[model samples]
Target: MSEPQTEQGKSAMSEIQIPEMTGKVLACVDDSVYAEAVCDYAAWTAGRMNTQLSLLHVLDKNEGTTAQNLSGSLGLGAQENLMQELAELDQQRSKLEMEKGKLMLQAAMLRVEEKGIVNAESRQRHGELVDTLIELEPETRILVVGKRGADTESAHGHIGSHLESIIRALHKPILIAQQSFAPPKQIMIAYDGSATMRKGIHIAAASPFGRGIPHHVVMVGADTDVARAQLQEATDVMTKAGFEVTGAIIPGDADIALAEYQERENIDLMVMGAYGHSRIRQLILGSTTTAMIKRTKISLLVLR
Candidate 1:
């Protein structure tokens, strides 16, 4: 016979039994400036895809460790008392953070509802953001997140530390929201002839996210015959997919050239491959992908 279920085991089983809500536009929310934008973009996406919007707030385990650290420095009997006090304090702090997350998720739900997502849902999980996202991946249609979180809000030009990890961890398409939201009027694809970028092109072609938006397939390199050919191929794919396609070849670095084209054409969203180069090459020469993510003022739709 099977062993009798413990309370904890029963709780875990209940969690597992919760129905997977597939085709949700999952937006990660926090006490950050970008949280509102995340909601807005997610609402737009959900509306476009005719799906539900789900907001997630993760209370990172690494946060609130100061109490524990302070308890570690105490000595003997005082240390024991301090440890107990610290443990209680840590518990209180965790509770407060979770409450704060609940409020944040409520506000996000309201924001998205105002944008026409009526049946939005909110969830709060205690763990690393990446791990929470990974567990929720099966239910997610597309993951939307802000470029920076509350912890990294003032650190201009740097993405949230977990941003890259979340991108690498999940297979679903990620929409990285900018500081503000604007309904996309035009979108630019930073296309290269690489297999990764080709896959991105196909994803863009099929996705409802950019349907009916004029697409600019911008390739940054020497305006060589090969570059022209590659640009044409990308544009042709998008055109065949029913987008109004415009192909261009600009001579400059990828990040700089793409940003320039975006501003020049007033592009609202950028679609591109997430990390086309090897980690070793990226470390040695720096990553155009990271630079573009940092520099772009518009929202990004990053495909793996």
Candidate 2:
């Protein structure tokens, strides 16, 4: 993941290399088609990294006050009976869904096991999704989430609705899985002149994602000597660190250009800051951290 030079068409220096990662990976699942896809993708990735896989399912109870309102709308006696029925039904449904999800996860675990991944395990919890995921062993290398969760029906929707809060709360790297993907042999790293981006370059230089993969470093802004200098500094850092960096200086709306670069390059993943320029606006719009969850179709590593 070393940064390279482009102004004079010179190549960046290469540095020491590390072995491929085979650490613990967490894959969040629910009773949805997307969950199944995520598990499959996770298994494939985990197998490649030679890492253990943890299949996590968080049973969220905050579906809102719809059930409460329905219970109270009925007469006192009838309300009690209706509430009881609804509660039982909800529990039953959740149980059934969990059962199906577990079966799906087990199937994925078996696939990974075939590849000699011996530490495959599964866990189910009845609590908030974000809180539960963070509770997992902090040594977990990556958290793999789907681009859209089971609750989303539109392309622009946030599948993992809690992603914003989770990104802000957790200090780890996140990989947002797109609809369908082969292993990302080519990844695009969005390099803005920010401390977060600095850390991102370091991570790319050191993490499993950047190992043996092509990394493209892109700076989105109006072309100018100042912009070039800023990007050059980043490129220098990465180049010194022994990363294979590709340089780009593009012009357009920031978000739009980013998304476009991802598509144009056929990028499989995007690593960038979650709450830099969009921090204030993001908190109000559930934050820029979460907005990316709704907008992109590639895996994202939101560094804090």
Candidate 2, overall lDDT? 0.67
| Highest TM-score against the true fold, candidate | 1
| Cα lDDT of model 2 by residue, 100-193, tens digit | 7678667767755665667879887877787787777375777777766667635465455666667766766677776665677777777766
Give the per-residue Cα lDDT of candidate 2 at 219: 84
Candidate 1 lDDT over 1-304, as tens digits, reads: 0112344532332133212224799999998899889999999999988888889989999677666555556677898888788888888888888888899888888888788889998898888889899999888989999999998988888888889898878978899998898899999988776656666676677677789989888887777765666666668778888999999878777898899899999999998877766788778988777898899888998877
Q: Pairing residues by index, what is the TM-score of model 2?
A: 0.78
What lDDT does each candidate get?
0.81, 0.67
Residue ranges of candidate 2 with Cα displaced over 4 Å: 1-23, 47-50, 62-91, 114-116, 155-159, 277-279, 283-292
Q: Which pairs of residues collide in candidate 1?
A: none
User: Each prediction's TM-score against the native?
Assistant: 0.88, 0.78
Top candidate, metric lDDT: 1
